[model samples]
Target: MDLLTYIFFAFLFIHIFKHIFNILTQKNHPPSPFAVPIIGHLHLLKPPLHKTLTSLSHHHGPVLHLKLGLRNALVLSSPSAIEEFFNTNDIVFANRPHALAGLHLGYNYTSLPWTPYGHHWRTLKRVTTINIFSSHSLSLSSRIRNEEIKHLVERLNVGFDESRAFKKLDLKSVFLELMFNVMMRFSTGKRFFEVGMDGDEKKRLIDTLTKILVPNTKMGLGDFFPLLTWFKFLKLDQKLIDLHKKRDDFLQSLINKHRNHDPSISTNDTTLMGTLLSLQKSEPEYYTEDILKGIISMMFTAGTDTTALTMEWAMSLLLNHPEVMAKAREEIDSKLQRKNILEESDLANLPYLTCIVNEALRLYPPGPLLVPHASSAECTVGGYRVPKGTIVMGNAWAIHRDPRLWEDPTEFRPERFAAGGEGHLGHGGYKFVPFGVGRRGCPGAGMAVRVAGLGLGALIQGFEWERVGGELVDMSEGSGSPTMSKLRPLEAMYRPRSL
Candidate 1:
């Protein structure tokens, strides 16, 4: 045979051997749909991504795998599968994926949410849990929360006549401002939205914050195709860089202002920043400026919109179901025992109100898909091999709405969470994961529940709410947001209830 024939035969033999080896050694991967070249299954991902993912899961089963461009993803939509992953493989899946947002917006992945699971992450978690969200810290902060709720109620009472006519109010803005103020007070001992405040500064601050928090649903192309990032065709990185600079500058200004103030003489020393600065004095190594700013930013970015969105959603649900609203109000009124205002401490006794908030969280979680987790090492989940570095996401929204999990799952029945109901919030086994589950569950769950409960109970006690124009408040979820916000800003008619 000639040299060409020999070479061809050799190549054929190698190819055959390789194919046989692959067949013998290939790992058992989860089910996946047809993937096209280059883009993989990215085309299947549409706006309101949770819903889109749910549809895919329905067709492919709960433990579905997909190739997202150059990345691999494992999506779990069933309680049993989700329980297996988080419970059995929690450590293996504790790391977060290196998304572009984490790089630019997360202080280069050092922020609490984006940091890898390790000592630094553990330290950050400890600080936040002990200093900010602990029962002791929350108890200390109760006065701040109560004062803010009072301001919110008083603001809502403005311009009301004795007749108590319903007034049209933009509840989205109302809830947002209340939460921002509450968080701001916790962080800096300042309220940005008080009446008679400097309008220009308030507008400027709100504009900056709104721009910073605006959801950019357009995933950067580089995130999927790393090589394309070098070209920078879309300028997503540049935009994020600019926004980060704006955020950093603003936070640094707060630090400097507090630094210049004498905490010994200033009443503002009780703020979260002041406490951190004091800690910095004692433990400079751990409480660096970036750490302080990261905590503050986490509190604002993670805490504010989500808590506010929960309140707005709860209110919208209450408006749509007046019976539920009335029941909640009755619970609050009876619990208060002639006291007109709802306090944070009162929330514990108002189980039905708590149920209402939990139900709202169930129907529309702030994060429909919990923060994505990346596997640190290969692990078995649902008896399928999830390779190392594969991105894992649990579709909490789908699980929450799964008819198999709850009867009349789509209905607005807070009673499902009441005593003798299917389950209570935070107690159900992986079935109720609005705040996620396992090692990486949100540390701020306690604070979030308190804020939501207080705000919802206050509104229910203070207002006789009605749908505007005799039409239902739009309950449609907004697209392109990291949080599940209403597509239409919630508008409703509310008048002070004559207590």
Candidate 2:
């Protein structure tokens, strides 16, 4: 045999021998089902990946060690597993996996979500915590949130010329428009879609966002096998390059406009982009134009779909169960005096409404697996040794629906949260991690709750809603790369209430 053939045989033999030795000797490893050579357990992965992982967790255990290509993943489902990782190993597990999305959309692993846990990530987190997501910041934007919801109500009213007659409305589109308007107005000081805009322009913008977001949200093959990037078979690499150009170009325009913006402009007119631009002056080295764009892009992509989809699911669930809807409306009407709207400040007093929002969050979390966290060093979880650089994914969907943790796990019982002192706070511990529980958990959660509460409360208070054709709204979860949304766009009949 040739020298090359001899070396290949020796390498293969050593690889198989190590596998056999690890299986026989490494009892500290977490239980895993059989994995194939080279590809490992990648073949077992299916769409709506959380469900497949949950099934594996169910059969083997909550803490599972699986080989996903060359990478090792620790699948966590139970709250204990979550705590052990997020608490004991929080720092070590704070790093993110080397995702393809991070390479392109996350500004080369520098965005808040994909940035490694270090000084750089710390700075981004500080900006979000102190400047963006602070209670003061949310209060500052309350006017924008209220105004956008009112605009939505107006558009909904205009759609139905007849006062009391139900009109067929594509709620998915309505919610999307409202969310996009609110998100854009709050972040960029402009609206991508509004009345009197060129129809073609609006369509083009929507199509571009979809083209970027739809694929970014889904886990690409390039993520699992980097070698596939060499071949032109998947085309993910080319697609990402094209998308990054379009996205960066668009975001750059926003930054440039704000750079030359008037300083005397009111804070109400000043947006997240403007605020960041102002900060850039003080910390030019830290807050580069690229960082500014990354923050806004992350805000737009992360904030828009998640907020809109959560509201859509909440409404769908309420339509499927009307008694819960009546209870929520009554709670609002009794305490609320703002005509047909619920103020952002008013969200706290209405406990039942908050419960419904929390329930929806638990049932259909925007991100089922949350984001994949990686270990910077070796760690022990659930009495098993996990290697360094393991990708840790917390299955929020499974944990939220785990029967052991929650009573009637599959049932939509918001009262359970109310019965305890939880009341949408997700209780005292990690029992409910709708927005996830960790240092890297979603920072926009507080703002998200306010948006959902005000938007949903206004709809319930001002209108009468029912499923079209007197049928129930479908609650089947749709497969998404980023968020598990409803399989179908929500369509419902609505009419103005005789308030």
Candidate 3:
């Protein structure tokens, strides 16, 4: 009886000590709003999550903690705070949050974007950087980008009304197609999303891609509340399951096509898949077909959509601010090395155009929250304790529009990026992380910049664009994950520019 009493006392003492330790560690945690049971701040969240979080940051300081359902999210809105997270505590937050998309679309979390920081992920990152995103790799892909831009020019020219020379064209589709074609040509050596191919196949591919993408964009209930994952009688999970099947089938068909092809017969062998296939012959274990598919998946989803959205947003901003559009056109026309066709290299000559693109990125970053990083271990952010397993998000949207960091933050001022610009991409540390920062930042940033700049510059140089009507284009923010896009597709009148 005495021994039992002593054991009970020891157990009680240990529990008290642990509770005290937790209290001490949590003392410096960032401020949070009142949270309810189970759902926490999940109810406070609304669509266009970036905007919502930006508002929250304004109230709860630049860095704060929130209970997002069962998940704890540490949002960093200040530039210095973001720098500390990505710099000093980078490796700690290098891990990715477990989401349904990672399970379905990310190839069971083994893919580069979804995988936790480790040897395998490191290998994928190295392969992506060296083989795809390096300057040399991009230089090799220049021919493809140039060819696709010419196709865009031709598409725009033919679609417009001949008599008036003004047509209300859906530039959203045009830019999307341009990006899709560029990505496909780069990845699979095929041109998809262009006019006059197989109607059914086109519809199938577009529909399938849209379905797959829409789910990822949604802030699903299961993500914040894991218990809800099993109770998905709501059909979200079913839809995802269906999407996974379709995507698998589609990608498998492409893989089989490459697999069955006779290497000698294929004249165009410079495709990314083809290159990977060749690598597979030597290192089959490391460079498996699944890894190739994962790489393709990342490239196709990331490469196509982000550039398309940037171009769309840039075009929309220009349309609303006609003076900016006119100024950009003037810059393009005056200094363009090739008046007939603007090459990717020509983007360097147009400083104003670069400013326009940068400003557009500032206004609407493709990935506003920088892809939901997670803390692998406890760390300090903004001098506060960030517990292990907490979600760490850099609010690029907030930082971009922070009145402290930018003058006329809401305005479309491309000149802000000029000599006296308040926020310079290079100088602003984490203040201007549109493409993100540190180790887990987008690896495809180099290629994405080249594509967006060239695409935007060429469109400006090649066409005379006018807003459809006197009314301003509706710049409503849309739903997207890993990218923020304009809700309404940009429609505008266009005519070919005279040489």
Candidate 4:
């Protein structure tokens, strides 16, 4: 044969051999629905992503795979599958996916929540656990929580009548302000939402944060399709850049204020920023300005809204089931006999109150789909191979409400979490993971539980809560956000309870 003919035949032989090799070596992947060209399963995605994934899992299997544009995704709605992945392959899947929000808002993925699992992440976790979320630290900060809860109670009590008439109030705003104030004080020893604070300053701070946070909750097209990032028409990346600039400026101002302040000024060293600043003086190489700002950003972005929304959901559930509310209040009243005010210490003794919180969390977890985790190495999950860089997300909402897992799963029964209840598992337990599970689980779970417990318990103890206008508070969930929020903000009528 001539040289040209030989080259063509050789190329054909190589191609055929390669195709056969691929067939032989292909890994066993999980079940997936039909995917289209280029877009893959993107067309299948709908709003309220958790519910969509749950339906897909039901149609497919618990371990369902999808090609989200260029990315590979695994959505697990089964507790057994979740346990297998998170337990057996915890460290392999500890890294976070590279998204637009992590690039900008997460300080280019160096922040605690976005950074890959490594020495830096370990160091960040240690610092936060020791100085912020440790039991000892939470105990030391109890007074701040107590004071903030008191402020919230006082603010809600304003404009009350002698007859204790029920007054309409927006509990969403109340809970948001309370959480922000609590987290801000923990970080900076300042309360931005308190009454008589500079109105313009509060507005600017809140506006800037709201602008940044709302976008972070969304998953942009660029996150799934990197090529789409080249088109400026998308504008999500540009918006994130602008928002991060504003956020950086605000955080820098706070750091500078703390940095330049006199050390003798009332022992500010106890504050989170102050503690980090002190560490900066000693370990300047490790704790850079970006690190400080990143930690602070994590404090607000990770800690605030989830706890706030949990409170809102808990209250909405309580309003819909006044019997549950009465039971919770009765437990608090009987436990704290004549104390009137619900204290942080009082929360430990309130088992029924704890059950109520657990039930609320089960019904509507803050992160219905826990934060996305990425696999760093190839691994097997549920007998299927999960390639490196595959994004795995546990549908906590589905697991929490799985009919197979709980009796009357849809019902808001707090007693289901009492002794021998299915929902009574401890943290890191796959069957009941509101705060996530395994190595990368939230270190601040203790603090979150305390703040949420104290806030909800106080509200139940101090108020005669009722649905506004005889209509049930809407229990619908919001869409396009990472955290599950109420579609309609919760508003209720309340009067001071007569103990």
Candidate 5:
């Protein structure tokens, strides 16, 4: 045979072999969207992504699989599907969704939220749970929180109008102040306004840092593409590095001050940074200084905004549904009438208040996506193959609003969590996973509940709240990574209630 004829035969054989291989691999996984070449589903996403995903869920089933460019994103929107994540295949979804925020908060992938499944993540989780988020730590911090709460009450009292019987106040700033002080005490053993900065500088610096940390714009192409991350188009990569450095410098300064304690002065049991430093001494390799800084940053990013956002939502919901608010207020006032202050133990008797908080969390989970989870190993869900390292996100918003799980899912009715109610917040209905589930669920759940419940309950007990401008509260949500807060700050008038 001629050499040209042999070459033609070889090319044809190779083409046929490639076709056969494609057909064989096609059977391994279920069908998905026709992902566009460069941008997959980027154009399909609408404003308020939660609503869009909810609509898509009805059409695509509970566990809809899709591609976000070469990246894979599985949108799980049902109780059963989420149950599979928490109970059946918990270990499979142990990793986190690799996003810009995770990397930023995790300090270049050192923290738990951004770390992949393995020794590093497991060690971090264990240390955090035992040393930082334990019940003992929370009880110890109660005195500190009470001190801050006292200041909050004093500020509100001074803000109230003595002549008019009611005065307008912006609850957002008040809550922000309270949370900022609390987090500062926990992080640096000092307050930003108290020790770090004076006059307007404190507020200005905090505001600027907050804006940089939580930018509204979509992350540059680097975050998603990974390959082009080194490119400097929007200066995103450089900006993050700069922000990290700034934050680290501030945190380290605080740490150094704590280290150089005066012999004459005594300190409280030890701050979060102190504990992290102690941990660093033992596990030098894993718990390095950078890792400690990342943990502090994560706590700040996760803690402050969400707690205040919940307060805004709960207050707004109570005002809108006067009956629920009235009932809750009555219960709190009656129960705590004798005591001058509200206690965490009082929370158990106030089931209705608990229900209301649950409902708020359901309607407006602080973290809409719940710190994305990644696949540790190759797995399949709802007949789709998910290879290892694929980023997975549970649509907490869609699951919370799933009609099949709750009656009138969109409505903010706290009755659903009452005794014999259809869907209790915890346990069975995995749909209302505001704190997420599985081993990596928010370790600060107990502290969050106590602080949120006590703070909000205090507001209800101490004052009668109403819209300041004689307008109804707008229930629209604001945009943010991790936390979906109120777009418009909740402004209200306060009138001290008669005992």
Candidate 6:
């Protein structure tokens, strides 16, 4: 009985000590709101995290640290802080933790976005940058883009009328087709939209992809509270597993079929899968089947909704601001009026068009919070010691709009990035980084900009766009785990050019 009493007393003493230690540590770290001990500030997050975090940054200085449940998150909003990461500690901050969703999606520490910084990551980056995402590959893909754009223009042209006749159309389908077709063509040498898909099949494919790409409230129970994971009745685990199976079945089938065929017999350039498959023969271990799938998945996930959403926002911004729209259209008409189509080469000469795209990205970056970046080693960011494995997210949205940096930051002003105008934040440089900065920044940024420029320039040149019912276009943001999109689907009336 005496021994039992002593044991109870010791347990109570240890618990008290732990609480005191926690209090001390909490005080030393950056100041944050009073949060429930275990849950941290997870409950504070609302639909548009970009806005919320930016507001928080305004209140809590530039570099704000918070306890996100068991995870540690650092939100960097200041340019100096961001530059430090890009210049001084780029490699140290390049690693990323594999989140539960990433695991359930079958990436399992293999995806380029989640892979740790090491040989495997280096190899994958080399393959992605050099072999697949190279300048050559992008140049080659221009033909595919042109073909898809032709279809888009033709589809819209059918709505033309000499009088005040315009068609109110859903652009979601058009953008999805453009993105998905390009992704598949690069991955499987097939186009999901081009050949024999019925209306229902096309809808199903689009629906499935949309469900996966957008963030949902449904994922919270698992992400925040792991104890609930054992209860499979929720079926969250099963849903993710099913998504994995469906994705793999489709991708593997393509890889297998390509493996059987002779590359020499194919007249077209080898797809990304073909190149990776060929490399697999030379380095089987590093280039595993899952790794190949992860790479492709990264491209698809990274490529689709973000690109589509940016175009949607660009058009939305133009619709809301007719003056800006008029200026942009004038530039497009003057530059490419005689030509049958807008070429990628024309992008360099159109500085104002580039500025318009930059402004759009500033307003709505595909991923408001970039793919979670993890610390590979101990480092100090903004005078705080960030231990290894601590998840670091540089709030791109907040950085883009920091009042300290930008003049009239919230307003949509494309001229900010024009040739002579001081770019974002009143700095005479590429101050706004929607694609992110540093080595782990989105590799497809250049391609995304070029595609958006050509696509937007073409639409402006070929058709006259206006809001439906003459109502103001709502610029409200939508909910997503990883990306920020327009809450209301951007619906606009388009009429073909009279000329």
Model 1 over residues 1-499: C-alpha lDDT tens digits? 9755764566456546644663587688888898765567999999789999999999999999987766789899998887888778788888999888888778888889889999999988888888898889999999999999988787767666655656676666677788888887888887768676554675576656767664452456667766546556557478778888888897887788788873422336678988888889999987788888888888888888799889888888888898998888778767785465788999889999989889999999999999888999877776788778889899999999999988899898988898788866436577889988878888899999998999988877876777776677678898322222221211232344322
- Tens-place lDDT per residue, model 4, 1-499, is 9754764565456546644663598789899998765567999989788999999999999899998866789998988888888888889989999888889888889999999999999999999989998889999999999999988776667656555666666666567678888887888888867576553675576556666553445676788777557657657588788888888997888888787783422238889988999999999998999999999988888788788888888888888898988888778878876455788999889988888888888889989998899999888766798888998999999998889888888999888778877776633457788888888888788888888899998888777777876778778898322222221211232444322
TM-score of 5: 0.85
Q: Cα lDDT of all candidates, in order?
A: 0.80, 0.77, 0.75, 0.80, 0.68, 0.70
The digit string of per-residue lDDT tens for model 2 on 1-499 reads 9755764566456557867876786758888999887568989999678999999999999888888765788898888888889877788888998877789888898889889999999888988777679989889889989988877766565534444556666566667677778877887766667676654676577667656553455556677666556656448677777888888997787676666663322234367876787788889998887898889887778788788888988988888888998898789878975354667778888988888888999888888897889999886666788888888899988988888777778888878768554334455467677777678888999989889988988888767777776777767777332212222111232443221
TM per model? 0.88, 0.88, 0.86, 0.88, 0.85, 0.85
Which regions of candidate 6 deviate over 4 angstroms? 1-19, 23-27, 159-164, 195-201, 212-238, 260-269, 424-430, 479-499
Model 5, runs deviating above 4 Å: 1-24, 28-31, 99-105, 159-164, 194-206, 212-220, 230-236, 262-269, 282-286, 479-499
Model 3 TM-score is 0.86
Q: Model 3's lDDT to the true fold? A: 0.75
Q: In model 4, what is the error at residue 311, expressed in angstroms? A: 0.5
- What stretches of model 4 exceed 4 Å from their correct place? 1-25, 197-208, 230-236, 262-267, 426-429, 479-499
Candidate closer to the true structure by TM-score (higher is better), 1 or 5: 1
Q: Model 2: residues >4 Å from true position, as ranges?
A: 1-27, 198-204, 213-215, 227-236, 260-269, 337-340, 419-426, 479-499
Error of 4 at 208 (Å): 4.3
Model 3 pairs in collision: none
Q: List the residue pairs that clash in candidate 2.
A: 217-481, 217-482, 218-481
**lDDT order of candidates, top first:** 4, 1, 2, 3, 6, 5
Model 6 lDDT tens row, 1-499: 6754764565456546654777676434555666665567888777577778878888887677776655677777766777776557889888776456667564687778767778887878888888656788688777767776666665556535545456675566667777887777767666767544555887787888666543331335465545446556666467677777777776676677777773422323377777777778888977899988888777777787778888878887888898997798678668776366667777777778889888899877877776667788877766677866777777878877767767897899999887666573433233577877777888888778877887887777666666776877777786322222221211232335322
Q: CA shift at 478, candidate 2, in angstroms?
A: 1.5
